[model samples]
Target: MNKIKLVLALVIFISFTALKTKDDDFVKRSFDAATPLYTSLLNLTGDNFKNYPHSFLPNGTVKYYQIDEWTGGFWPGSLWYIYEFTREEKWKIAALKWTNSLESNQFNDKHHDIGFMMYCSYGNALRFDNNPKYQQILVQSAKTLTKRYSPIVGSIQSWNQRKSKGDINTWEYPVIMDNMMNLELLFYASKVTKDDTYKNIAIKHAEQTMKNHLRTDYGSYHVINYDPKTGKVLHKQTLQGFSDESNWARGQAWGIYGFTTTYRETKDKRFLKTAVKMADFFLDHPNLPADGIPYWDFNVGQAGYKPDWNFDPNRFKTTPRDASAAAIASSAMLELSTFLNGKQKEKYYNAAVKMLKSLSTDQYLNTDKANPYFLLKHSTGNLPSGREIDVPLIYADYYFLEGLLRYQKLKK
Candidate 1:
């Protein structure tokens, strides 16, 4: 018994040391990698740092948008992450400048992504410095976001009634799984203001999502359209996914991230289990790429009740990879790993490490300064629209940086 115990103890020590080395290497490489990008981004955003970077256009020029754009907050948020990582005054200056640009978005209640916009940027900014303005900005952003919540639907509204080329117009109120990520701002708001209203709203939204959004195997649909008056689910569909029935890779990641975050805030076991199940669906799926990234949609080319994708995973054809999804999932998985033990913990932690290692490769990371300023490559956005197929994306970089920071924090 003593001899067996000694061998097991030796194995555990070696494994832990190896993981420590890998984690340390990731933080070092990540810090080195982000420095030049920060310099480039600072110069690129010279005057109009408020303009949210969407992605690089095909011609290799950078594209920027207004605060109302969903992606507007990530640039400033990335600035905050780099600032925290490097402890440099230059990054701090740029982070403050860019974060302050979105203060007015606190009044914009047109959508539910204020969490992503304000919390991610201002939240990180507040972490480094406790500015009263940042606090007010976050509280106001949460208040504005709660305005979109309907007591009937029990979930915050995701998309406004807008006519688009896709099927986003088919519902009175549509709540996608991605909205789960927005609750972080509400949680923050509840904590700061000592108001349970914001917390209540967030919990209701999460409960509604748990009841309606997931499939039997825990994979989630993209959108759940509802009857606004009665709060009954009208139909489930997909907007950015392969088909209405298909599981979009990024959507799954968003669900897992959101639930894990919710579990973090509320300590709800249901949220934790749901998050675990979603992670399993993403990690255990046979279609998942060997490199740890995923195809745009999990059900692509596989037969289902209503299969929108016709591409096969094993006998691969031309399918786009979603690095953005992988980054998001890895970040979420790292957090989830903290909540588990034994083999389950190893599964998630190792899966996340595998993904980070893969993303650090040349195939994904953009080492060339001449190309787009975006970090990760081959991230898909609205494949049905044929827009931004296999290109660098802003949120991809944001989450990649966020994931690296998560790994670093876990080590500490």
Candidate 2:
């Protein structure tokens, strides 16, 4: 019996050691892959922080966007993640250069994405350096964000109205599921300033979103249009999904991530419950692929879920998988797991690990030697608009690195 027990212990020790090494290698590869890719991007962009790398064209070239674009912060946010992982001064220098370029946006209250633009960049900077200037900038951003909020709508307006050819407005007080993500800036401002005004606006926006934005199955609408004066919901539609009723994969990911952040900041059980429900809906959906990536929309091939705007029958034959959604959800799940215990925690943690593993594979990890500017591939952006149908997206890489770091910390 003693001899058998010794042999079993030796086997278990070897297995555990191998598993640890494998996990370590996986994380190392992610950072190794990112460092060169971002270095190439920096080389291409040439210290010009105003033009941010957004995505790739069909011809495999990099697409750049200006500071006013919604995706401007993700590039700097990715650099911040790389710095956090490696603690290299070079990465910090790059991150600061890109992040500081957005300082003037703190007063630009044109849209609701100020949180994404400022928080993702400056928020991560504050986490590492704890600089007082970053705090002040974030607070100013939160104040600017508040300008878009309507007391009647109880939510922030996502876009300004655009006049069509016939002089009809496109939308009235439109709020998107993506706006859920901006609440983090408000919550952080509240925490740093010891003021409840920012916190209260965030809570009210979340409450209104919960009531109006989510379907019975917890699938979120990409956009919710409300009457600016009456606060009554007028349209529950989508701008990017297969149809107004279908669950857009990235929108669901945003819901899960945002609600999880809300729960973390507020400890409100309502937000926690909503986050879990949204996560469960995404994970358990029938349309999600075996590798955990999702089709651009959950109802992509379904009979009634076809979009009227860009109805491409050929595209449905090979629907693009959105690695960005998986990355975002995996990162969110890791954080969500921390708030749970027992089997629930294990389930989410294991699911997130599986997602990270899937994303690390060569099929998704962007292994082309000829083009090394992007991290992950096969991300679908604005499918209905016929844009970036299947390509590498900056935000996909941002969240993938974030998921890797979160997983590393949880493992330790």
Lowest summed-lDDT stretch of 10 residues in model 2? 161-170
Report the number of clashing residue pairs per model: 3, 0
After superposition, which runs of candidate 2 have C-alpha atoms over 4 Å from their true positions?
1-11, 163-169
Per-model C-alpha lDDT, please?
Answer: 0.86, 0.89
Q: What is the lDDT of residue 65 in candidate 1?
A: 78
Candidate with best lDDT: 2
* Error in Å for residue 253 of model 2: 0.4
| Residue pairs in candidate 2 whose N, alpha carbon or C atoms collide under 3 angstroms | none
**What's model 2's overall lDDT?**
0.89
Worst 10 residues of 1 by lDDT: 307-316
Tens digits of per-residue lDDT for model 2, 227-261: 89999997778678888888999999999999999
